[model samples]
Target: MENLAKKVRSKKLSTRVDLTAMVSVSFLLIIFFMVTIELAKPKAMVLDSPDHGCCDCPSYPDYGENRSITVMLDENDKLIYYMGLLESPIIAPKEIKYGKDGIRRELLKRKNSLLKYSSKSLKPESIIVIIKPSKKSNYGNLVDILDEMKIAEIETYAVVPEFTPEETKLLAAN
Candidate 1:
């Protein structure tokens, strides 16, 4: 009877699971993944100036027929565009709305015409665009116009700060 009591132990054993290492490994894996993730890059445009460095006088581009287009960015997403110069326009200045139907349509037409003349003896630098922004025009308008220039695949374009007096008068009357 003494041997049987000795065999049967009185102390009770408890079991515990340690989850500290598991949590540490999980956090490390999360940090590793977070650090390795790649972010999307922003879109940008490249602008080139027209200076050949021959003379001190900046050679002004000739405003020829079917060679240039002038766009005026006005208030409330309004665009006034004309071909040639601000004085004697190829076509008189016309007001148009933004988006696919209005400005985009005009641009596409001009692009198609330019493509047509490309097979002819036309200079590659024939299409020069002058973008004049009024004080009333917002930054969003400028971005949209730049985006449109990209969409149109315009080779050369310049952003002039202020419009001419005549252009301002035309906008006021428009």
Candidate 2:
């Protein structure tokens, strides 16, 4: 009878598992994941966009059309750019490809030209890029153009949504 009692006690002892180590490990794992997730938050790019809603917003007309260029984005990655005002352009609206040899080259060329002109004329003048994205154009194209602007170190640029009748017709015809 005593042997039987001892055997039953042994079985009860075996059944009782020590869960203290498992609990501590689980809590440590939970804490580790929490800390990792908190540290892994995504970083964002800072863009200083103009406040269009303000009535007293500054205009760039004083900068002169000579210092300005307009880039129109269309479907299928088509980029049309014109120097100066559309009414009196230094360079007429023409399709240009993207990348180092395309828009970047043009931007650099124009920037260098403006620098030379400014040095000779003794005036404050810099390249102003006006970006106009058509409805058919994708967000990726706009982002790409913005990236190009940053790559070219452009200081003044705007993303204007409105398009003139002539501009719309020009885009449609192209």
Candidate 3:
């Protein structure tokens, strides 16, 4: 019998790994998160005031004293408010606290009264607020009062920095 020779064979294994799919998946995840995220934006408040002696300034109609409310901001977070003219005010100037129960309540009450009165007549009317911040009053106080005006929804308002002599005395006394 002839001797049979068996041939020995060696097997080769792959040394490389497929990383293209993994890289593609990682990039897809990164892109998805970037597209879905939202960036922060700056917030701003709208201020409406009359232009100072501008030749092309639009003329605004004069508002009545009956529909006016003057608010004075003092130091130590004290607030004073009055209605109509200071000389002959429909509502006398008085110190009031700040917040929903304080200035806001007073504003709403006066606004409703004026609305009722105007409703009887044929002309449309709204409350006009005059914000006067005293020298001793801080900027935060001014911001708070402005916020109150917004809360009370008094559309027509002005920020008058200068104070009258009587107003100065009134604030000094308070």
Summarize candidate 2's per-residue lDDT along 1-174 as a digit string, tens digits: 878777744334456888999999999999999999999998666767877677787564568788889999999999999998787889999999999999999999999898888887655578999999999999889999999999999989989988999899989999
Q: Is candidate 1 or candidate 3 better by TM-score?
A: 3
> Model 2, residue 41: displacement in angstroms?
5.6
- Candidate 3 per-residue C-alpha lDDT over 94-135 given as tens digits, one digit per residue, 9 for 90 to 100: 999999999999999988988998887776688989999888
lDDT of each: 0.79, 0.90, 0.87
Best model per TM-score: 2
Residues 1-174, candidate 1, lDDT per residue (tens digit)? 888877966687787899999999999999878766733345566555555686596464655656778889888888999987767777778888878898778877887787677757555444677888899999889888888888888767888887678888998987
For model 1, the run of ten residues with the poorest summed lDDT: 38-47
TM-score of each: 0.64, 0.76, 0.70
True-structure RMSD, every candidate = 6.4, 4.6, 6.5
TM-score result, candidate 3: 0.70
Candidate 1 achieves a global lDDT of 0.79
Q: lDDT rank, highest first?
A: 2, 3, 1
TM-score pick, better of 1 and 2 = 2
Please give the lDDT score at residue 62 for candidate 3.
51
